[model samples]
Target: MTITIRSALMKNFLGDSPDWYKWVIISFLLLNPLVFFLVSPFVAGWLLVVQFIFTLAMALKCYPLQPGGLLAIEATLIGMTSPAHIGEEIANNLEVLLLLIFMVAGIYFMKQLLLFLFTKLLLSIRSKMLLSLAFCGAAAFLSAFLDALTVIAVVISVGTGFYAIYYNVVAKQADNNSQIADDSLIDNPEHQQIMEQFRSFLRSLLMHAGIGTALGGVMTMVGEPQNLIIAKNAGWGFVEFFLHMTPVTLPVFVCGLLVCLLVERFRLFDYGTKLPEPVREVLKEFDRKASAKRNRQDKVKLVIQALVGVWLVVALAFHLAEVGLIGLSVIILVTSFCGVTDEHDIGKAFQEALPFTALLTVFFTVVAIIIEQQLFSPVIQFVLQAPPSTQISLFYLFNGLLSSVSDNVFVGTVYINEARAALEQGLISLKQFEMLAVAINTGTNLPSVATPNGQAAFLFLLTSSLAPLLRISYGRMVWMALPYTLVLTLVGLLCVHYALVPVTEWLTQWNWISPPSLNVISSVTAH
Candidate 1:
């Protein structure tokens, strides 16, 4: 009886994850506190950070929340980071939290509109390369003005919808229609092959669209959460922010599009998988049936969602309110007019974002540990101490490398604050500060695409239901993003190294951008 009880308890831990994984997590929990006491807290803190990232990398084996949360709880108990500091981190990032909670849910209510539009586009575009470009270009454009998370949510919705359409068709053809959730139900080798092909097709498009968000996201203040943080520190308004980034961001953006084309054209890094014809036919039939069944009320709902999407774009463009509040407005407007009043129905919308929100909160605990430990301080000091001629490129390179492993928003916040502090002490010229600010923005946004954890959108997609369905593990995502990551990081580095100074001078010469004003700097620094 004792043995049975112990076995049951072990089985219950992490709920069907691999036994090795459960043991690894158990080991992590046991290791953190011992290291904290026997070793320096700083060393233990870095170890915890690596462990947290390990959990994230193994996200496909189990959700990061359970294992990562356990680590966080252990950290707090061991005095690596206090609950107070964790709360402070969460409080500081409340806006981003709200955006995830509400904006993603708001977009959930509009999935039908997204599916309708994307299905049409999918059906119309026969050329895989052209379709890839459309996905990349549209994602970039949307992410430029709207939130990357929201744009990625839309893409995920479309991917899920398309997958379901083909999945059901395949399941029915296999005479296992009731087992829709199980991929193993399709015993026929041909059906299984088509399914694999379909997954590859979706994977390519998703990679393109994901990279698109990064390409356009670095271009404007509203493109990323960190971009706004950098802009505020530098006293840049929306237009000024856009102009400031144009030197590096514009060239990087063009190069990014070109990379997309070259990869798709050459079929590099799993990019050229064409949508299987049978799956396309299934999607077409599903769309036809869906269209035929659509009533006037359904049409009205689509129209309402379209209008709300417009509002989402405009509100975000104008900085109408905190993004979360705007997202809440979208939720109220979308659900109320769309006739989705049931409590259960509305609750389904929260399913996608809530888990991610919880994971993000847990992520803040790790960030708190970093803060309490000052793990990044030495690197910041090294960069700051470098000569002015070498400082810009170092800042860009270090920021990119750090952001690839850590949260870009946190990395940007820390570096930008240090830069602002230097300026306040009159250590660097205002012009040099401006250059550093742009480098920080581009650095954080561009190369962080190397890992799922580097960008919130990538992390969100990694944890979404869609990733598992598409077989997009962390390693697969990294592999697929390699070309874009290399191109974006290398191009961004060169532009920062060579083009930024001359381009900024020209922009200033033509009055396209203003030199940093001492008065503005002083006033901002005063607060």
Candidate 2:
């Protein structure tokens, strides 16, 4: 009986995950303490980060929250980081937490409208290249004002909806023909190939859209969370912030669009997969049925959601309230008038965002460990100690490297604070400070697209329901994003190194930027 119970418990652990994966997680649990005790806490902290990333990389096998949370709990219990520090990290990023919780849920409620619009887009745009460009361009434009996560959530919903519509059609046909007994149709080779082609097509568009978020996400103060932090420290308003980033962002944005075209033109990196005709027919039929079945009430709901979307854009652009609060207001308005008062119905909206939100909290725990261990301090110190002439480029490059491996927001926050401290000590002039602030903002935003771990949008997409169905994994995402990452990072770095100083000089002469010496500011402005 004892042996049977032990077997049951082992079987219950990480249910359905491969036995090897289960053992790997178990080994990670056992190894952390030994490394923490016998080795330096710093090494142990870095090890924990890598272990958490391993969980993320194997996300298709099991959710990262369970395994990553286990590591986080162990790290805290072993005194690598305290609960208080974790709480502090969460507190520092409370706005982002709220955005994930409320904003993404709010987006969930708008899926009907999103699906309707995107279906039309898919059918109308016959060219795969144009369709890809549209997805990328639209995401970029939306992300410039709305949160990147929110924009991606919308895309994920639309993509999943698109996938579901066609998948049901295929499954039903397969069932009628009795060619495949399974629901997935994996046994039917022809349908399997068609599905694979469709998945590839969707995957490419999703990747382009993901990169698009990064492209536009660097343009404004509200683009990314860290953009606001850097803007506040540099004392730049919206127009000034936009102006400051234009030197780097504009060039990168143009190059990014061109890269989008080139990749599709050459069918590089698994892009340019034309939408399979069967899948297109399925989507077209679904769109036709949807449009035909639309009643006045349904039309009103779409209109309401559309108006709310407009309100969302305007609200975020004007900084009317904290992002999450605006998102809450959206939830209230949409649910109140759209005839969705049922508890279960509203609760369904939370399903998509809550898991990722929990994972984000786990991410903060890892960030807390980084803080306690000062793992990034040496990099911070190195950049700060670099010569002034080269400091901007160094800050840009190092922030990019660190952000690619860690959370970009955390990396940006730390570097900006350090740069502000330098400003206070008169080590760097306000002119140089403004330049560094730009570097940090662009650095964290542009280059961090290299991996899912680097950008929250990419991470969200990787862990999202759409990822597994589309066969998008961590390595796959890195592979797809390679071209955009290269173009954005290289263009951004060159512009920062060569174009930034000249642009700043021109802005200063135009009185758009005040000369640091003429303005005797006491210290960097705190957010």
* Best prediction by TM-score: 1
- Local error of candidate 2 at 178, Å? 15
Candidate 2 stretches greater than 4 Å from native: 1-62, 78-82, 163-199, 221-241, 276-282, 405-410, 413-434, 459-475, 504-527
Q: How do the residues 1-527 of candidate 2 rate in per-residue lDDT, one tens digit apiece?
A: 45687778779999989999999999999999999999889999889978886777676688888998999999999999999988976776677678767877887788778767766777899898899889888888878866788778878878887777777676765314223224456557888899889889999989998999999889987678788667656766566788889999999999999999899999999898999998888888777887899999999999999999999887876678877888899899999989999999999978867887798788788877876787766765677688876889999998898788767876787678677766776778778888899999999999999988778899889978788888898889999999988989999999999999898889878988667544325334322
| Number of clashes recorded per candidate | 0, 0
lDDT of each: 0.83, 0.82
Query: In candidate 1, what are the lDDT values of residues 1-527, reduced to their tens digit?
Result: 45787799899999989999999999999988888999889889989888887877677688888999999998999888888888876786676678678877887888888767766777899999899988898889878866788778888878987887777776765433345468876777999999999889998988888899998888877678778667767777667788889989999988888988898899888889999988878878877887899999999999999999899888876678877788789889999999989999998988877887798788778877877898766776787788875789999988899789867866776677668767776778888889999889998999999998788789878878888888998889999888889999999999998999998899888987777883247535543
Worst 10 residues of 1 by lDDT: 172-181
Per-candidate TM-score against the hidden true structure: 0.85, 0.83
What would you estimate as the lDDT of candidate 1? 0.83
Candidate 1 stretches with Cα past 4 Å from truth are: 1-39, 77-84, 167-196, 235-238, 276-279, 405-410, 417-431, 453-475, 505-527
